[model samples]
Target: MFKRLILFILLASCFLGHAQTYQVEKGNSKYNAFAFIEAQKIYLKLVEDGYATTEILSKLGDTYYFNDDLKQAQKWYAKLFAHYENQVTPEYFFRYAQSLKAVNKYEESDVYMVKFNTSKGFDARSKMLEEDSNYLQMIDFQSGRFEIANAKEINSSKADFGPAFYASNNQVVYATARESGSVLRERHTWNNQPFLQLYTADADENGVLGNPKPMSNLINTKYHESTPVFTNDGRTMYFTRNNYDNGVYLQDKTGTNKLKIFRSYKNKGKWSKPEQLPFNSDEYSVAHPTLSPDGKKLYFSSDMPGSIGYDLENEFTRSDIWVVDILADGAFGAPRNLKDINTPGRETFPFISKTNTLYFSSSGHQGLGGLDVFTSSISPSGSMGKVVNIGKPINTTYDDFGFIINDDTQTGYFSSNRPGGAGDDDIYTFLQLEDLREECEVHVVGNVTDHKTGDPIKDATLVLFDMNNNKIDQQITGDNATYTFRLDCDQSYILRVVKEDYTSNEEVITTPTSSGLMRTSLEIEINRIPVADCDDIGPLLDIQHIYFDFDKFNIRTDAGYALLKIKAFMELYPQVSIEIRSHTDSRAPDQYNELLSEKRAQSTRDWLISKGIDASRLTAKGFGERRLLNTCANGVACSSDEHQLNRRSEFIVSGFGEFKDCD
Candidate 1:
């Protein structure tokens, strides 16, 4: 089982001494030792001899469940529910639901999950299922982010997993239970296979691995040693091993040897004697070490104290990913639980990629079934973002874990125990087609400043609009006078910055097509509105001169452009009121010109009112021949351009006492 990395035996009282037969007790001994294969044999023989109990049926279901044989597990679980449904606990309901899901009996799986939820209140796993009832559809929709295949050249018929990149030599180091040339190798009672040992193999440009060989004797032992992670410089290694030291294997008070992480340094072209990390405890297991890309932090899975979902009676119920800061003095800070990433189920085999993505395997989060691979982004300040499933075929209805990747090449390796593998757990190489984090986003970041003073302007609002003029996002500048909007890459956006008493600024920018934290910096500078006295008639808001056809009072298309600016200015300064004054040249009759001027002014006011401006904020007045700018008076011979000046509109500021001060 995948739990072999840090084995835990959760024995029931029936497995202790309550068995009615000697043969059943013998089976119980094997089961207690995690030898599920041997225990299954004895349990199957008893069932064929017409001997079965609730304990025997439950143990049979779990034996297949732990061995990754979900079909058989489902069969036994069905029998358990049929004969002793009321006798089993909620844990069995969860396991049976998972097994049913593995066989694609989703409807039946949901029935047991609901039953499990009814029995177990406030369980995060059940809540996740309830929230994402369409999880299978979601998984199918997000599939095919990776192209994966088994690494056949280095795989054996036994378990081969936990691959780590040895970048210094362009090789990959992994763990395996394959036989060495040694004639007398001890087998682990848990699986009846030789203990896992470290092995290195060369990986080519395409990430194909071959030419496997055992690692140094100092690193490997007759006991278990696996899951090695090398530092960026490849001068140091952190690996998992049983609690063995000073030429002696050690066990805790419970008579069980727990796993511990050991660090080995490379000096003079040889690996130094490994030393156990200070955080490892004999009472709890700590294994599967991974390092941050910068090598300033170490992450590993453990069931130590304070681990989420840690049970004192059965510590194997769950394990969480924990991290510790690698200090400058080569020591470690206190470990912190990744509370955001861990759930009430097992979360193990954490690997941080070059892009600061934390990839791990977990049965806690919503997945297809079993432990599925998941990824979460790490912020610059070391906070965790949303956790996302890497999706199929990188994940399946079986244990898929130990994911590692190279951001530069977009290729990587992971381990899975899905069917069609050459071993119980085989390492597979994959080419990532897309990032496992959220979609391709570009951070649109910039500062808003005063145009004249060149000083940052806080409290400025920036509104983003897409090409279709749809509002996308909005941000307000803080004390730093900076605004950031995360937008899709390779798209054009219009960022409009608006501040009180300042002219609004707009900038159209196109983001780069490349991915991964791309940023477009734009600094917007806005000018303060000029001070104007009451009753002043002028184009003070930088609006263009309004013009119209001869003797026509209708608002023309060209005039609409200037009116739109007036509408925007009115919206910006809600307290300002303006009077639209219209004038005409002396060519028309005096009474006709007065009527035409009034019509023009009324049309302008009506247009603004139609655009959602309050009627009280505007007034229309006809100043026919009274406020002519040029010398185009009555009966005077003048150029048409000179008369055109008179046939224009003036926006008189009637009420703006609030903006009296220029500053």
Candidate 2:
């Protein structure tokens, strides 16, 4: 009976799996909620039983998504459209095409790319599709032979990371498990036992940081209180806390509690009043609280119910990030799962930039082993990018955490406890780069010096950009903000300099690579400017074209128009990666998007890979939100324009990566 019922759900849900079957049949929710293993099994059974339909295939894709099974998801989604040949719905065609690309099936996936060119959501999807990879996919392993910070004899020590900057105050706040121990305390995997704490220090806009000191106990909990952030005024502080109340310690011990967030205030020459965050819970847990630069919103991690199709009450859930806006009355609004940015694997430690870019940590997504940093961007109209991994130097076989940026200056901070650290985690500083972005050959070199002092700007932000106008590399100048970058001939470059209170200066250097690599760097002079200079122009995108292959539901050749635009964007930004979103037009089964979009996004990503793009830089997804685009979803009375727009494949910049086009 159970197998039969499971079979039914598989047919009903489609894209099924063996490992996830019984749970779907039982209907018991998960703690982290990637997918009910049972549900996954039932879905898989249907596929094995020859009951697979476009709809069933889509559900199976969805199951893979929740499990962070990008490859499997990509496979099912591809099978649907890869061989598709017929007048199919726009959503399936576009989405299936993209899914094939995401898994590096580029040459094969482009076929379905044509349908998306004229799809309804082309406008929104274009912006994302036309993006490229940057340094933000900083997995330490990818550094090739570059010595890791933890391996270098330099400043590796303590549980250091999570650098938050207060531009107005010229200070930084971060978290470290360096507190309360001779060496760092052992990290408890299951419960994340409370050992981390908050700390602060002085930082120059140039990226130079002074020795950090522990935050007063008023804000740092006896247990763990890491990931500190502050308001623009620097008065109010928001932080993530692991407490006795939040039952993280109860692993199999079976205690009923939850993880939480806390806030504090500095008053009368002293810090006081540490209070529990009101929205936290015992069912699901919340940690790593980060506030928007404006202090009007709060973002954090939780295993809470309704977050990415999971229930936080269970013990086995993987952690995903969630966000809540700060209401006018200073109250926190209900938490909402950052859907597009998160998946079945774990998404945690979210950080946001003034540019609507995001940074976070994840274990489920592809990476070295321990956690790695990932990024995404929120589009002009409020959509998000598919989460992409930060590769090389910044991330590694160990864990990386607390990624924060000083927007205008292109400087950033994060922490790690890789083998070479002094003890646990130690804070490390880096700068975002733009000019001299090519891997080798001729390079551009320059210095950011004090306009009046003539001294090199130590730690001043030096950003290097590519044609797409986004930052590709970042590092603090050992002496001054003086920096150098290697570039290919014929590629365009942009470099910017910024320090707190100092007016930001950007220089553009376009050397014809075809003319051979050349060396050039003009000094950047900065004067103190108000943060208002961070003004943002709305992003624009055009849906180029979409295509499909013979008999495949996934994309194939001929999708180049749309894919190249994405490639062009990546070439331009150097610091950006895209989240290719796939969808199925309403003509197919409702469950198709889960598979179709997953396949399409992945296919689009894979195509880019074939084009020499990095896999870590792209994230693929299937929204099945065909519900919103399908005028037939609610049987709404709408125009063909609206309906068509909804049945398209799209892309979004989901995170702050090496490709920020800094001005």
Candidate 3:
């Protein structure tokens, strides 16, 4: 629609008419009717009078195109092009090329497209078509004329949008503009009166939805509220809501709209009243909040300040991709802009897959018309990568957005206004074809065995936590006394091992933000405390472990509580530099492990470097696991634990960075 408005304005300014001018009467009531026919009549008359202008010719040509009168559309446009030749704007080339292609004048269409004035489209389009014969598979998807969804009435509701599903509970919560419940609050941003309010429906285990119910007052305020995404545990609700400076509005008598995120807590069978999320960027608008399956990373759509290469005044219309790390304390890191995923065009409505793949809506990408859905994978460490368009059958020349997926089942929901809808913009269910076998995830497998009995603990939950208490990802140890988590290479996660019988254990698992090896393996051990001796000073209690990379001691997320201890150790004992030692399993090359170990040790040292640890006092050593505490060596067929011991990293007290020898 915005594009249509812009095109209308361009037509008005660039097209000039003849003596027999045609004015679309305000109350003509023929805008989409024979409006173009009438315009063509007037334009031909003007041409006969020798009063036709290039602008008039183009507008009349556009009218023909809109009316599906392609032959005439081509005739007028081609005449205009012949007169202007290479002096035409990119708009002219695009419009005329489209018209030419429509009239089966491929050669002429190529000529005009070759005359395109800008490199942006030419470059992107060529790259897209260079390798793939199928336009749908030519590029990866995120949005714009790819990705599709069906729009239909899920209930008797007139309008439904802002939909979210609880993959575990099989329930749905969405914002609807239709009158609902006993509430009649103003909808504001949505065309005013009770524009949007949260509604929930019972989506059974198979994702089939039942009767709709308005969300509680605790979650839906008088103002517009919608787009509720569930935490994996289903204990918290995060969504978008607009706020008016109610206090200020009461005093200043000025009502201005500001949108922000709000969260609600579920407790004892009731929901806590929604409250504003912290660290909001008041400088820019924030809306459409989505969470990662693990609940540690939050993916939201915002027009927050980070958008580069574009501005708000013109693009209020345009939004960029923004994300923040959910810290251990649940506070967010400075929300960062994913410039790589954003375009000069608008980007919005982000949905993150359990695999950490990001699906978003965009009007800027080469789209059909209104908006399209696109996808990109997030690095295990949470860095976003290039997007792929979800091509045809999923996208059309209409608004297709609000994509939500339950990747595990290959099923999801989206919003679309395609034909056969109950009304304007209905929700559609999609079952993505799973025929393409994607790369298998590498797993860190082992057991949370009791340190004393060496027996696997049953019913223990192995939760992965980041520095921010936000759960990065979680996998419960299976009944087999073994737990497995599949993570792509390059993820830094700290796992928390917990059981009711004993103190919790901690282990480190580090993956680079990018995979360095084709495969990696890990084993985590949890030492159990005697259930009777509750006061045991077991080292397994609430330990925080941080790991480093081989031969490079930068903080690589690996197993255990020592890293948290390191952080606390540094906080308690500031001005300290520690010697970090990296060892290996000995079966490998000695020099390789030694240097790798040294580098790995320094990685931890550097993690502390910015934490006020004096660099001069910090020393890194690579033992290559040469002096093993057990009988494991580079060539030994040792037990897994022996192998684990050989790969251990430890630190000793050092002076500080400044006291060390100058490089």
Name the candidate that leads on lDDT.
1
Could you give candidate 3's per-residue lDDT for residues 1-663 as a string of tens digits?
999999998887666532133343311223223345555665666666675466667666766655434556778888887786555445556557556654556445544544552423553332222222122323323223323345343533455776897647587787776765585555332222345778887775556666877878667656667778888888888888766333221211122355778777889878887777775544555788888877877777776555752553331335777777788986777778887778655688898877888888875554444467778888877667656567655665556688888767777778765556766557776667642223323445565676655676767788877656678766565434555555667656677877663677676667555522222222334432222211211243343223343334455444434565665655554554555666666665777777777776766667667666656656777777676778775566777655655565665544432333222
* Winning candidate number (TM-score): 1
* Model 3 alpha-carbon drift over 4 Å, by segment: 1-157, 181-194, 245-256, 281-283, 312-317, 435-663
**lDDT (Cα atoms) of all candidates against the true structure:** 0.83, 0.58, 0.60
Model 2, 139-180: lDDT tens digits are 332344222233122233444566777547377776665534
Could you estimate the TM-score for every candidate?
Answer: 0.63, 0.42, 0.47
Worst lDDT run of 10 residues, candidate 2, spans: 529-538
> What does the lDDT read for residue 458 in candidate 3?
65
Worst 10 residues of 1 by lDDT: 654-663
Candidate 2 global lDDT = 0.58
Candidate 2 TM-score over all chains jointly:
0.42
Query: Candidate 1, residues 530-561: lDDT per residue as tens digits?
Result: 64546443446665467767899888898888
1 versus 2: better TM-score goes to = 1
Please report the TM-score between candidate 3 and the true structure: 0.47
